[model samples]
Target: MAALLDSVRAFFAPKNDDAFLIDRENPSDVVARECLLDRAMGVGRRKKSSEALRRNRVPAEGLALVARDTSGHVIGTVRLWHIDAGITPEGNAVPALLLGPLAVDADHAGKGIGGALMRAAILEARKHGHGAILLVGDAPYYERFGFTTEKTATLVMPGPSARERFLALELRDGWLEGAAGVLTASGAKMLEAPLKKAA
Candidate 1:
């Protein structure tokens, strides 16, 4: 039992070499920043780039994934937000991880790196015991990865996007069977602080 626990701890422990691939603690790292910039350019739709950055910080210890090229320049990035996954309508708890800001450099868009980042994020979330993931994005693109709008029918979000746009994916079978009101506790606090300041 002791050896198993130690092995599990070592499995998720960060190594020096991880600096080249990703930095979960410091999203503002030079390579990470460049990857964000590259993605913004590639998407060519910057309407929510700033807001996305703020939300990424809204989580506790933002988990950042960075992709680098042969020359060691960061070319892609993805992030996961920690959220409450609030209680379901049936009174069951549902903890979730919110996925977002998945971006790849314009030069690296078609090379499958973005997909790799998504897979990594999902696996990591499951390993950490998260029940589900919620996000707003295309159906066709994310469908291939088992993401669906099934849970959106029960979960209520703050935004006004259509039902199809908001999606969820259960990390385990029946994970979100009766879950609802999935929102980040920290995100809610951060958002409230800004509103208070504005008032």
Candidate 2:
């Protein structure tokens, strides 16, 4: 019996040191992700500048991801949205992704799940050909993942935002260099107008 239990541990432990697995977010994870975000970030998070860019826009393809435990319950979530990070000094638009609302279930705090989700999301973004990613987050926390305040200093947010919290990571060298102006949503809109009632 002890040998059999050891075999089980060996099979699963190497894959994820934690009991959680990171997967692309599916339709089913939406509700759980929202509840988890609310519990972790509070109801007031919707007012943040990041939320403004995310509102009515969909995440970049395969860039929305969630972390699920062995039981298949979403315990963490992270998403990257298409955005105009800013404008180049040459009067050209700089394209980048917006990473935000990354949250872990309150009960699952301290499990390193958020970091895992960040890594997974960044990997997916790179694989999909994104050049850079921007976010409003703690410098120390995101810096470890290659995010830096230096890259976003000249960029602006559509709504109010703290300069210190605006962070960025360039997947390609010089991606954010000379980037200026306000960030804007450049993703596919969820809707152009509210659906009309049946006549």
List TM-score per model, in order: 0.68, 0.88
Please provide, for model 2 over 56-152, each residue's C-alpha lDDT reduced to its tens digit, 9 standing for 90 to 100. 9999987887777888999888999999987887899998999988998877778777887887777777777899999999989999999988988
Clashing pairs for predicted structure model 2, backbone only: none
Lowest summed lDDT over 10 consecutive residues: which window, candidate 1? 4-13
Q: lDDT by residue for model 1 over 1-199, one digit each (tens)?
A: 2322232232221444332233242434565654466557554434542234335355524345566654566766666776655676777667677777677777666666677667767766776677777777889999988899987787766544567877888888887777667354444334344344555
lDDT of each: 0.61, 0.84
Pull out the clashing pairs in model 1: 83-184
Candidate 1 deviant stretches above 4 angstroms: 1-62, 90-93, 182-184, 187-199
Q: What range of 10 consecutive residues in model 2 has the weakest lDDT sum?
A: 4-13
